[model samples]
Target: MITPTITSLLNAKAFESLVQSRRSVRKFDRSVSVPEEAIHRSLQCALLSPNSSNMQLWHFTWVKSPEVRARMVPLCLGQNAAKTASHLVVFQTRIDLWRRHARWNLEQTPPSSGSESDKRRMQLMRKYYSVLMPLAYRTDPFGLNTLVRKLGSFLLGLTRPVMRLGGRGWQRVLLHKSCGLAAQTFMLAMQAEGYDTCPMEGFDAVRVKKLLGLPAGSEICMIVAVGKGTPAGVYGDRKRLPLEDVVSIV
Candidate 1:
């Protein structure tokens, strides 16, 4: 609510430079540190991300120490970008957070016979419980952890959504598109701040989660690093099939 009331919304053209400037920068000069405040600003932008129920389910871990970064680099498929970049962020989605937030919403009741503080507490409880219940229906978490896991694969179109290979469960693959959007938003923000960046999913999830001490029911969906790009930054070819190939009309 505190965000400014825009007299006009941003047109797609208004965001042209941001869209054009964003690139998966693979090389960086590692001598500098991304200002901690700028890192916070990048994460703060994600706070405004839209979620299934305003649960703000995304969490980010910033890796700043050299040894830790080296440990994580191998986990990320030996990508040196994770080491030398000024910022390395591991973005994750918390199904547990979603489930808990949802159940809390479903369990709320009217303010009981109590003081105003109790009444406020009850009101808050009701709000979250309401949000969570709907999400649970969409997620369908029954006692059938097996069934839920099985169904999650089907729903998410994964061979195994939570197989328990290492971290989290079997790990469904759908998060890249959703979480990738958040990472893209980060890259765009970084670019707008004159920072170059890269996102990597081509790594061992099991290893990276350990490096970050991620909680269970969470998975490292993507990694992003930011800094000034090398003069010979290896940018992939940018090509699109065409609007006719991808767009549709009602």
Candidate 2:
């Protein structure tokens, strides 16, 4: 087993501070520049985020070209965050690569040790990526696959709990959930690197997709603008519902 470092054990307060200090910075200091290494490290940390079934049906596009960045500003509705930021990272979901990813996962299964238990475990892992993944992701122009999944779920759930499956809409939601987790991780990592970010959802999706040349099966989750934030970027003090109102212990 891996050993935990002393830094990890004593970093709880540091982590809390990091979370508290992070803000949705709307304006960036144009004179200040963020290092390329900071963005590289933050993206690396984002890759380690938890995802559904380890399929990793996500992609990050770092817009470093000045030409593209200028074009993206209007696409992002001419937001100040996009206009003044040093970098813009686009988070996207690639549901069309499910088959390739599933096969890759199956290939990663360890070879059996000839023991019955090991053999069975390998068999299950193989089936999970090969058979079950297809069952979850496959779609057709007609609604036949969706109908079959609904019927199967209903019949199986009568006796035991089963996952409710749907068509493309459900698949998109699942991928977006995973992509959102990565985006949060990226933002936190950027904060740790002494930078600021603004996750912007106010964008023309169709035009952005066309500009980025994204495939039809791919969907943008969010675009995060990163830079050295100005003091005025923080609009006001943070506000939220009291813990008693928002939290429940059962």
Candidate 3:
């Protein structure tokens, strides 16, 4: 393992401050406009976040148009954060792109004529993206694929540990989990850039999807409102249960 240096320690402290400073700001200062460039940078940072199998099956829609943003207000339930924010970003999970992404991951492997280690790495990547991903993500209207996965796991685990996989529902949950991490990365990046964000999950998913013209297989993970925050934006002092009660030392 690499030794921790002064730079690493200072970076850790800075990150601790960033995490503490972040809040779910509800009331943005309408007078202060957040730059569009900052949003773009934060989104690029979000794309670098770790995801399942490196599939990167997520999309972000920046609601920049005045007419569209106005229409989104009602879809967001007229929350003050949505109304007063300079920008709104819609985080989405693109489950339909699984096949394409899996193929993309497979294609990223090194050539067959490379070194032995490289060859081994390439083979493992191929197996993961070509065989395992398809089995984990495929679905059917009658739950047949889910039953197959359940039985497969059960039979394989008769003598050893195995992962219990389901069908479409499990796939959806997995995609959302990755997409949510991307959303958190975006929010934290915004905070690091001296802006505030509110992640709102209380929107009408169907209407929001229609407004964005998203595909049926896509899911809206959350809508994040961004801008400079006001004093009233913070609801109260930060509060959490005691560490001993929330965490268990094993």
Per-model TM-score, in order, reads: 0.70, 0.95, 0.96
Q: Write the per-residue lDDT of candidate 3 for residues 41-121, one digit (tens) a residue.
A: 999999999898899889999998878988999999999899988999999999999999999888877688888987888
Q: Which candidate number maximizes lDDT?
A: 2
TM-score of 3: 0.96
Candidate 2 lDDT, 1-250, residue by residue in tens:
7676888766977899999999999999999889999999999999999999999999999998879999999999999999999999999999999999999998898888999999999989988998889998999889888888889999999999989988878889999999999999999999999999999999999999999999998899999999999999988999989999999999
lDDT of each: 0.68, 0.94, 0.93
Where model 1 places Cα greater than 4 Å from the true spot, the runs are 1-14, 103-128, 131-178
Task: For candidate 2, give the lDDT of residue 113.
Answer: 91
Instruction: Judging by TM-score, tell me the better candidate of 1 and 2.
Output: 2
- Per-residue lDDT over 43-157 for candidate 1, one digit per residue giving the tens place of the 0 to 100 score: 7776565554455456788787767877787787777677568778888877657565565545545547889888887777775466423324344345454455456546666
Q: For candidate 1, which ten residues in a row score worst on lDDT?
A: 163-172
